[model samples]
Target: MLEDVFRDQWGRVLATLVGILGDIELAEDAAQEAFALASERWPRDGEPDNPTAWLITTARNRAIDRLRRDRTLARKTEQMGRELRDRPEDTMDDTTKLPDERLELLFACCHPALALEAQVALTLRTLGGLSTDDVAAAFLVPFETMSKRLSRAKRKIRAAGIPFAVPPAHVLPERLDAVLAVIYLVFNQGWGAGRVDLATEAIRLGQVLATLMPDESEVLALLALMLLNDSRRHARMRDDEIVLLDDQDRSLWNEQQIADGRSLLERATALRGSGPYVLQAAIADLHIRQPRDWEQIALLYGELGRITRSPVVELNRAIAVGEIAGPDAALELLEALDLGDYRYFHSTRADVLRRLGRDDEARLAYGRALELTAAGPEQRFLAMRVAELLPPGDRE
Candidate 1:
């Protein structure tokens, strides 16, 4: 009950604090204190009728106290004090709704002055209401390393005077890519790591993005792409084992998301959008269609590969090529790319090898994949592959 409200309202609460406090680090501290207070009091005093408004009131008071105590920010403290008195937003109940300032938070977090990784990290922290440890898990980095990175990012944002507001329309596109990349990375982390909360949060953020930038083709397409992929969430795993797309039960997929994604894709296409996101959305749409069109998907992946030149995109292209051409063609293409230690490359290679009757090589590829994989379902699936290929006596 309380947990759900915290998850849903944390961003709104924090965003409002950031706007009023005009400092990311300070606003975060205040928001955390406010939530902590809620956790302690809510269970005893009963839940507030307006949790968001209650939270905003508590957090703003804390921020005000901090600012008033700081001689360096005396002017800001006075100004904030006056604004608080004039508007009395902190006193609102059911009559007023908190402004969804998370868009401003996202843009501020993704300011170009900061490093790309910092942008992603900061957005997840504030917008997604993730703690530093959770952000570390998402990035697969050491806790201390992530802590330092986040601290540095916040300090940098302060030092650079990045505004907690959306950029002007003329400069919006330049920063749009960073914002989208941050959101998509959050979604992928959640999807791949089986964190449905994060995935759902990412989808929520995408919906907000679409509402804010209604005519932005890439924004719509990115939302479409995420929705299309996430529609299979329920069917992607079964009994703690990864389920391949070809084996998934269609009934388990979310039809509503599929319809929503297809509609968005159509909207993007109508706007003459052929960008990477639009292209990816188109390919995703093709995949969900019955009697799947492997050729068109392959061509779209080819174009996506050309534009992004990402090895992962090329790998996906090889998969579509494998479906259309054969395992041999896929293997040939896969072998040419330098994928480094990507787990998917080994797993895909192993599947290709298994198909070609190269049992020994396939086992080795599967072993490499197992070494790289940490997720339970994927590890089980890869181990199952290896176990089936082993000689009867050699099996564990």
Candidate 2:
């Protein structure tokens, strides 16, 4: 129970402290101190009826004490002290205020001035409530490297005086894409690495964004896209192996989530949103149907590709084109793409070559994909294909 509460409320507590104290390091320290106090006192004093409120009050008090102890720090934190002094008596009692601060923290972490990698790491640490070690593991970076990166990002935020608030409406559209990209990256990491907790955290962040920016069509579409994709989580793998989408057990898909995603997509479309997310959600919607319209999927991918000019989108479109125009056409289209380092591109090429009875080329493509991919299930699948393509005498 305590762990669950901490997981859910840690970001809120940290966000509120950062907003009030205007110091990321100070806020983190105070929040950690508050949690440490909770671990000791909650067991003895009985857990507070409102654990979140209790945490905020405790962390705020800790920050005040620390500020007072350091005379030099006192001058620097004067504004923070004043803000705390003037805060409404019931402010700590109101849990809703924490989420508002979390939104502010999200925007601050995703500030355009910060490097994109720093923005992603900082957001995952601060807003996603992930430990530095966890963030490092998620991104496949060394712990010390991630820690230094996070420290640098926080220092930059403080030195640059980046406001802890969402961007103004006029500037939001420009800034919003970075924030959404960070969230989507987080979701994609979870999806690719088979981490359910990370995926859920990303979805939670999406919901928060949707609630904060209800009228933003792209925000709605992003949430819809995540829900639609996550609906297949159960069917994505079996026996610790990757299951192809077509072979997945349809009964395992989350129907409720699919329904919610469809409704959200409808809302986005009603808003005349033809953004990449809305288009992707529309494609995912088609995928859930019994007989997917490959031509329509290909068209939507083309639209998305035209808008974003992403090679990845074009690669996906080629797969859809294969469904509509046969493997040869798909292979021809794919050969025009420059995704030499992308494992999936090679994997797709291998599939198309095998379909066209080009065993030698299929074997080579499968080998390239196997060499590029680190995923165990994907490597297994590719190796199986390579073996199947080899001559009977070379089966060993």
Candidate 3:
């Protein structure tokens, strides 16, 4: 119950307070205090009739007190008062208002002035509705480290006088990629890491971006990419074990999300030139479509490689190449690609070698993959793949 409430109301609480405080750092602190209050009161008073409004009201009241307590908070308090007085009462429950607020928050957190890591941390912290602990856990870092990173990021945002509003019209296009990347990481944190709520948080951001930047084809493309990949969440795991794409049960795929992704991708492509996201969406589209075939999918991966010019794209391309061109052909490309630094590079190459009757080479690749990888789910999965390659009669 608490989890659901936090997921849905946390963003609103932060948004409302940020609007009032006009300071991201102070607003976040105020929001945290409001949650602390909820933790203490909810079990006793029971959930509020209008939980969101209750949270907003509670946050506003708390901000008022905070402002009084600290001389530095006075400007924010007056700003909040003006904003509250000028807006309609319905603004408290306004869906439109929240999206715009979040959009602003997203852009602010991902401002180019900050380092990439700081941008990711701030986006996950402010917009993800995630705690410092959760952020630390996601990156497998210590709590203190995550907290310091966030604190440093907040300081930089304030010091640099980063604009809280979205970039100007002429600069929006230039900033769109970073914004999309921030959103993409949010979705990955949730969907890729099995944090469903975080994934939902990411989708919500994408939806807001799509609505706010309707004419920006890439924005719509990002939404399509997230929905397409997210639609497979059901079949991605079973009994705490991960399921590879080819092995997943197609029936578990959500038809609605797939249709939504396809529509968005089609529109995005027709409106503008293809981008890394649009290409990725196209790759996912091929995977989800009925009567799935490896050949057509391989070609999409190739296109994705061209669009992104990323080694990661090349790594994925190797997988498709393994399927259509045979392991020998794939091996030729994979061996030459300088992806050994990446964990999946060795793991994927191992899989290709295993399929090509090169047992010793496969084992060597898996060993290198294991050595390079951090111990995690992906590492364990790679280890299992290694075990599968052992001589059947000699295997346990």
Q: Total clashing residue pairs per candidate?
A: 0, 0, 0
- Alpha-carbon RMSD, each predicted model: 4.0, 2.6, 4.3
Question: Which residue pairs clash in candidate 3?
Answer: none
lDDT of 3 by residue, 75-178 (tens): 75666666655666676664445433776777888889898888988887887777888877777778899999999988987788887787888888768889
Evaluate residue 36 in candidate 2 and report its C-alpha lDDT on the 0 to 100 scale.
92
Score residue 21 of candidate 3 by CA lDDT.
65
lDDT value, residue 184 of candidate 3: 87
Tens digits of lDDT, candidate 2, 1-396: 877778788888898888778888999999999999998999899999888889988999888887767777646476667668777768778676554588889899999999989998898888777889888887788899999999999999989998898889999887998899988888887653323366777888898788878888899999999999999999999997889889999999999999999999999999999998999999999988878899899999999999999999999999999999999899999999999999999999999999999999898999899999986887998888888988899887
Q: Top lDDT: which candidate number?
A: 2
In the range 240-355, model 1's lDDT, one tens digit per residue, is 67788889999999999999999999999999998999999999889888899999999999999999989999999999999989999999999998986999999999999999
Residue 314's C-alpha lDDT in candidate 1? Answer: 93
Better of 1 and 3 by TM-score: 1
Q: Each model's TM-score?
A: 0.80, 0.90, 0.78
Worst 10 residues of 1 by lDDT: 189-198
Worst 10 residues of 3 by lDDT: 189-198
Which parts of model 3 are misplaced by more than 4 Å? Answer: 1-6, 29-99, 140-142, 190-197, 239-242, 293-295, 374-396
Question: Runs in model 1 with CA error above 4 Å?
Answer: 29-66, 69-100, 131-149, 169-171, 191-196, 358-364, 367-376, 386-396
Give the candidate order by descending lDDT: 2, 1, 3
